[model samples]
Target chain A: MFSASVGLSRNWEPFDAGEEIVINTLEKLEGEPKFFLLFPTIHFEKNNGFQKLLDGVFSQLNRSTPLLGCSVAGFINPKGCYTRGVTSLAIADPDMQVTIALGKNAKKTPQKAAEEFANMIKKEKSKNNSGVLFLILPGSTLPKDIFHRTRRISNPLLSSLFDKFFPLYLALSKEGVAKESEFIDKLYSRISEKMIGISAWDNNLGFSNYQFFGNRVLQNSAVGLYLSFSGEITIKYATPLKIFSEKLRVTKKDNSNYLINEINGLNAPDLFFKELKLEKKYLTEELLRKITLGFPISAYCGNIFFNRVIGLYSDKFLGLTTALNTPEIYISTASGSSIINSFDKVTDGGEKTNFVFGVSCAVLLEEVGSKIFEVKNILEKKQIKNFLFLFGGSEHFMTEVTPISSQESSVTTFF
Target chain B: MSEETMLSVLEDLLKEEDVLAIMLARKNEISVSPPPDKFKLKNPSIFSLLQSTMNEFFVVIEKFSSQGLDKIYFELGEYELMFFLIGGDTALVSIIPALANKGLLEVEMENARLKIRELIQKGV
Candidate 1:
């Protein structure tokens, strides 16, 4: 018999309690816990419980216990959001490699982190497409170098494309997560799946018989996880929806996590916003929301819509990292339907799902209301039990190689 | 909202051949065209609709030069659907999908602004 349980918990402010939940959840998952994943939902009721929670979790993992989890946007269980703590726990082989790390601690980019995390997978390793690397980075950092994706693809292709299997993921933080239950209902999944910033279909928690999470590797809290086997990890993404204006070359770049001496061949953020017919704040808010939604929000809270991002060419803003110039910088745009269709086709009662985090459109949130979050429970009910779904807003939760300046420190890959 | 415009916009954005209707809404009522059949305004006054779209989104109100500027959505079949916005109180709101040629859309959007201005003035 497959034994599995899930622990769901939350800590409201004032009480400042995360340690108790972690202790209990870890206790439940200890001995035979195949893989333990945690999605901490703070801010909704701020209480400084996170440190306690992290401390509790750290104490439990026994130094890299093959565990993966992240902070959540909103959480769910049989009951409502009255308290914060683990709701369930389980024991079984989801067949996934898991890792945990706070955003700041993960020095290298998530892809590299995944490579390191994958080595921890004892089960198997194959020359073919083993498993996909899931990168989770902190939302606050707003992942700087996503253009590294192309590099990921090319690297894998060289020696049978190990990097190709790695897809990038961002981790959204407090502001996004606090908005979780904004709309608990009213979303039309079948239709709006094409509407980015509206919905995500990749994962289903609507409880079913089988399990998900199998055959997948997980990187929790911006910590990367890579499972090595032979099956291909198919990737579909749309970034940088609109160039907004002529693509500019980066004159000088370095990743110091601060906007220091940045020279864009163009007027920088100003020109880009002018082309979009908006202001700087709009772009920041929109992109931040997009990162939270894991997609772009065309219609603001169902108000007015625009083209969403498909992908980004980091070098376009190359000055942010390498002191070189990236000529072609384009933002991707596409409908939400195809993504949903893919999720629809791939999801199954018995299919194992590893890790999934996404952002839903604010307008969709307005449209669906509470359904935006209630879907968590619905999905939990619909998906196979094996799958571990950690949902949050758009925040790049991966470690990117930030080329430091002459005065700063250099961060090379670990392991 | 005209099916043609809605169809084109939806096709480009969601890649959907089928689009019911799009709306620009707020609390209870319509600031533009009367609420369509399936659409109903909210409980608040007229400003609610305007606030819904612009307030939190870091929106701006620009009195168009012989044009208008408003982007909002409305309700359709219990589905608050539609891409058409209520522009400039007396203006125009245009939809530009990222996929299509960016330059061309910019021009067309400008023209649409003029047309919306003329219409708003004529009250036709």
Candidate 2:
């Protein structure tokens, strides 16, 4: 029998939050939990709070309980949708095998770090074991100088112009998604198991988030949890986006292929604004956020369309949060109604779900705001009783032959 | 609470950037911030319609479930309407732009509702 429970603590004190989380979860869970998944908000990282939090957690349970987690923007559980606090899920299943692996300095050496992570999991699992992999990688890591430079620009249009003219400087400064993509590519080369996870993020787009492995708190790391289970696993996703523009071909790109310089033989940013009928000079941070939330670049992955949020933009180029493996793409838009309605269809298929673990783009949280609680309400209406839903910088899942990184939402249901 | 004090509370809620209007309704009486003429000129029937709908919806919910209705939200094209049930027969209604930061607004609304409740207890 498999048993799972989710707990959340809004206590400001880190140690208390950790203790409260364990107490709340263990009270509902049966027997000894095989694994604990922690999702702490970035607020707990202050004053070495993560370490103290871990100390409190280990005080209650076994010292060796495998725990893997990362800083998230916020989370939604049975209690409520919260922006600040710690939430955790505990699973007690004797038949399931859980293994954890962490690779450090992922930004500095992605391929090497991924190899270290993949090799650890590869050695632990037999070839015949059917399982799913959960990953938590570092969020955007724009260098200090570049981040400060961008912060100093009060006008977004000027910032866009600056990035467009000095592409090399911006390229050298940002290393989050590009490095993470490389890490995923290299890890897939070693392991063939289906993967689903998210990149850790803070409420602000500050790019400084931590990952937890056992009792250790880390940054710029890749953490993976492989669960080898004999039961069934169902993967479902919701992309609250629809095609807004006709298909356009990528005519020019940067060396990394993540930056689009020209689309349909025209300047990428110019065409983007023109197609959306947006005034370039009037662009502000709020407007940019609205565009990122409502209008994302969509491309075909397998049979379904995968959406990528715009990360960086300049007059000369458009940078996406994830690199597209295809040249054909279209702009997609989402409304408040569409976003809320899409959650109704997320768990449509017939499957007896025992527990659900969900990861959604933080952009959705920003878009919905307090309306996020309505999403939890919708899931409950679908009869999903036990679940932990988190908001992160990006969501990741694997297709049959390729790994897909998106800004939408995905759920991994265990039965 | 005096009429001036009640108006002050409603005015404070309107200070939020995206909050277009605010109304406090109890039984058949309704108090609208910025008065009814100035803001209601855009949508004359929405307020009364929403009030009636909320009451009807509450009746349906009370009949079907043991849980009390706490809040209701409606996304109407470019605008969003929210209702927060206060004590007694009173409720707070707010109209905001669709893109407003609802999470933050919810906290603000809760705070406003508490203030309104306190005022009501003191005799509004």
Model 1, stretches more than 4 Å misplaced?
A1-4, A10-31, A44-48, A54-66, A75-91, A94-135, A139-265, A279-326, A331-388, A392-415, B1-124
Top candidate, metric lDDT:
2
Q: How accurate is candidate 2 locally (lDDT)?
A: 0.75
| lDDT of residue A132 for candidate 2 | 87
Assess each model's interface with DockQ, reporting 2 decimals per model.
0.02, 0.14
lDDT of 2 at B31: 49
Model 2 per-residue lDDT tens digits across residues A75-165: 8887777776789999998888988898888866778889999989988875666788999988875555565313234457865665555
Runs of candidate 2 with Cα error greater than 4 angstroms are A143-178, A349-351, B1-124
lDDT of 2 at A225: 91
Q: Which 10 consecutive positions of candidate 2 chain A have the poorest summed lDDT?
A: A146-155
What is the lDDT for A272 in model 1? 38
Q: What TM value does model 1 have? A: 0.38
